[model samples]
Target: MTGPARSHTEAVAAVGRALAAYETQAGVAADAALVAARRIATDAAAAQADRQRHLERAEADLRACRAEPEARCTAEQARVVQEQHGLEVARRAVSMAERAVRDLAASRVRFRSEAAALITPGRTMTSVKGAELEAYLSSVGLRAVASAGPGSSSAGPVSAQRPSGGGGRDIGGLPEGFELVALDLVDVPDPVTGRDQFGKGYSPEDMAWAFSAFDDVVLPALRAGEGSEYFASLDAAEGRMGTRSYSDTYSGFLGSDAIVLEARPGGRYELSENGRHRFWVAQQTGRPTVPALVRR
Candidate 1:
């Protein structure tokens, strides 16, 4: 009985040893599982942190994108304002240029109007007859302004034929380098009546008035030291036949280059060129008289 008890105790001890070895292996495996779980937890935490940073950056970029359109709109508005200002400046310049042109045109018109009024004399006439005035004017060694008809020759006969008085032919006495020109038809008086269109008669007073008007109004307006041409036609009254038979100072004969003798009615013989160049007179001798009058 003692041997049987001893063997049983040995078997029990062996079973105890096996159980302890199994327990040790199980503890090692539990420790390895705990380390693996900690590593997995740490990896998951790092991945979550990286995701949060990415989300923050994306939100900031979205805010900047939202503001971009407003910035562009503000720039566009500024450009439009600049363009409007430039257009306003151009319009103002054009208005100013137009005003300057109008002012210059107004100045020119005023200058011409004042000049014309200053040169012509103001006169009024009533019952002024053309032929009667012409006859009166002619008696004072004056001639009326003649009209040259269109088809009439310039060098042809320049006189009208009256019934008597040697056909009343008058000669033209134009100075050198000047030609006779006719006045406008409206300004001429009627031939039969001695009146103008205004029914005014021309008298010696009128002639004197015209001469004075020329001296006062016309001559002052002329350039300094300039000369003008004047013509006169004279008439002889009836019963003044002795003085009526007028003779030109050069009626006898004239040469292109010869000096002639002019005999005055007051018992004195003088030398002249038909009232032109009449300063020297000689004592009735046929000595070639021009050499003495050379103005030396």
Candidate 2:
């Protein structure tokens, strides 16, 4: 929202491309995780069924054996015991599979929340006009296409439906009340602060490459642009930044919070987010400005 239209629009375009790629990647990944979870669940169910059948047969055989308590324990009794144990193990496996599927389902629900941060015109901006609307409408065009289905002449105004495109990482266009402004993450000069994830060091970006498409769009565009050392520092070679326990960017389709920024009394657009980690990462990576969605 600062700089000339050239940078803002260009920045918007870059973020747009990045978000589009991310949405694609997120969708594909969510689908894959679901498939994996379902497959495991199905396998677990089958195994449980098999074990149940074996246990039932074993129980039948044991019942058929009229064993005197003082005489001896028949082989059928031992078989029954083993089959019961097997059935228990199978039941545990089934339980674990079901749990994984549930977690994956929950992760998928947040995906839309993440995407809405950037594309959503918000409740306030719905009534505004001109470039802001134009830019919003433009971004909406990207998301609305795949969704609008064929024969739709045009994507309707964003107010027609809630926008959901960019992930929570970028603040392209947020809602109104507080002025929703686009700040180029790459252009933000000062080191922004949040809970530091870099003290022990950081994980390499490539690890995230496999999990998300941040690399596919943002990295390439930045590399092609002014060619800042910001990206040159990606710890691809070492496979890490430093000691780390948590997942890095793009580790999964974890529905993250938007990079919300509240203006301090000074009126400086330097305040900060629900997406604190993301904002910190952007500033650390030499990109705290362009892509951020902020409320002024």
- Writing each residue's lDDT as its tens digit, candidate 2 over 209-278 gives 3222332322222222312232222323223342221123322212143344554353344535444344
- Cα lDDT of model 1 by residue, 138-243, tens digit: 5655544432221111212211111122111222332222111111101111222322322233333333333343222222222112122110111111111221
Tell me the TM-score of each prediction against the true structure.
Answer: 0.22, 0.37
| lDDT agreement of model 2 with the native | 0.44
| True lDDT of residue 223, candidate 1 | 15
Stretches off by above 4 angstroms in model 2 are: 1-15, 67-73, 118-296
